[model samples]
Target: MAPTTLVLNAGSSSIKFALYRAGDDVSLALRYKGKLDHHAGDVHFRITDAAGRELTAPDAHGHADDPTSALLERLEPLLGDDDIVEVGHRVVHGGPDFVEPVQVDDAILRRLDALSPLAPLHQQIGLAAIRTIMRTRPALRQIACFDTAFHHDMPPVYRNFALPDLGADIRRYGFHGLSFAYIASRLDAHQRRTVVAHLGSGASVCALLDGRSINTSMSFTPLDGLMMATRSGAIDPALVLYLQRTREMCIEAVENLLYHRSGLLGVSGSSADMRTLIGERNAGARQAVAQFCARAAEHMASMMTALRGCDAIVFTGGIGENSPEIRASICDHLAWLGLRLDPVLNASGAGVITCDRSEIVARVIETNEELVIAREVRRLTQSRH
Candidate 1:
């Protein structure tokens, strides 16, 4: 059996995994994709082949030290005889230290753990998986592919803040870079000036000029850009202070409120998922969807300005690629900018959705962050040999 490469993206309650067959020439192709969703006391594990066919329905129950260990235990037997030679992780933050993907070591793990405070929701979970992999497969090489690395070279002017006393290292370090990088790779010559809107539960917009990240909606933290499913994005600092003084809320409570209880859930008093919000025929739900569209449209215009002018707008992520209604709404708002969407094409899902006569082109492209991670793993590991 040829050696396979495993790519892991660990979230707070979910771990997305992909296995790839690495060619002798350093090319990578996805073999299997799966996810483990742990909620309450139940553990749901499912795996599918590259063609979306179910290969195994493994019985995954209970938890060990963490979900990573539990997931690895269930997945080991399902891999058959394929040997996993290397592992790659989608680490959300590398701070100012790491500008490229690096092989994991003891000191590197410690440095990544120290960055937990910057990205509380993501770092801890990712580290847990990394440690679990280390314990389980000590012989396997692991790589840390940072989401912040792609935007590390953005212009200093856009990266800086207005604070006078702020240190040189403190600046806007954008997130969703892996997604942006994948989208940037798919752009053609005419789409040099593109605004890619990645509208998932956690959303952000990025402007790429000649495939380089010039500006993005996300700032120092992922919570600073577009309002997400549960995150209150881009709120005034004064409001937080007012809540502390008047509402007697502590720092932790305020953080919890903003990061876990706001956005669509707080606004609609319903579920956080966009599909749920769209299905509900209520004022609150409708208003919630409307607010998301409006805020996304507003940020997209700002991103376009960052590119001087937009040649094309590419939409990816959960809501961006699937929800035709949401896409139409956002395009309608940008109609004044000479963007015209074909209803038939938009509803059909994928490819160019814009009218040929439109001044600007719009496309729907599915992002593959795992492929990028796997490629990086092969590149970095092969370079060492």
Candidate 2:
């Protein structure tokens, strides 16, 4: 039986997965890509093979007690004779310790849980899935690939905070490292100095020098970067202090406000979804969308400064790949930096959105974080042999 690996990205309300098989060229090739969205109620499971063939298309009424486990069980028959040899989980926060993917064990799991306070929104989900698999499929091998691992080697100038470190492991630990790594892999040699704007619900800008992460907008936690769909990014520290002291809000209340009640949802007073906000004609909606784009642009410009000069800027993630208006808005702000967008191309979602004469080339590339995790699992598994 051929060997396969399953890559899992368990989020708070969704579980994204991909199955990969070792290709003839010794590369891990995606077999099936899927997502299980259980945001409000039912677990809406969907999957498609590499050829765009739908394997399991559950109806909107589908619900499960444990969607992750249910999805894994359903995938068993799809594999036929192929054996799922290992699993790779996308753990968002590595904190101050982890700098690379590691084979999972009881100790590692507990250590990861300790970092929950650092990434309250995302860290626990992946760990929960890992624990489930451990209890149910104890014999199966598992590995953890961190989102912070890619930026772990950043220079002190970019990694350090301004204030003095008072015995706490507090400093920038950039998120979306896997996405940035995949993007960097796709760039050509000439696209050495580049700024990648990963604009999903949780957005951030990363500057890559020769395909290596130099500096990124997301700092300490995923919440510190670009204003996301619900996250208030890079707010004044004094404002948090004011909320705690004057507003009389507890720490938990402050966390909820910053992580869930802020950004587009807070500003627009309607929806956190960019697509929905863009469709609305109200002033609040316009302001929400405008603020998101403006902040993204400002961070991208800062990332360019970190690069000294940017040769190219690539947009990836949900909003970055789909919304041309947002991309155009960000590019417009960088006009002084020689990033000129071709209106027609930008609207059409072309690979190259910038004009031929533009000094900085702008592009839109879809990111595949699953593939990176699959490869990492394969690497670790191979090394163990």
Clashes of 2: 1
- All candidates' lDDT scores? 0.89, 0.89
Off by over 4 Å in 2: 23-26, 39-41, 56-63
Q: What is the number of backbone collisions in each predicted candidate, taken in the order shown?
A: 0, 1
Q: Model 1 — TM-score against the truth?
A: 0.96
**Cα lDDT over the full model 1:** 0.89
- TM-scores of the models, in the order given: 0.96, 0.96
Residue 315 lDDT in candidate 1 = 93
Q: Cα deviation in Å at residue 315, candidate 2?
A: 0.5
Model 2 residue pairs with clashes: 172-220
Question: Tens digits of per-residue lDDT for model 1 on 1-385?
Answer: 7789989988877888999988887988778888888888778888888899987675577783378778767766757887888899999998999889999988999999998888887887888888987887788888999988999989977788777857755889999999999999999987889999999988999999999999888888788889889998888889999999999999999989988999888899987999999999999899999999999999999998888999999999999999999999999999999999999999998599998999999999999888888988998988987
Supply candidate 1's per-residue lDDT for 178.
90
Off by over 4 Å in 1: 78-80
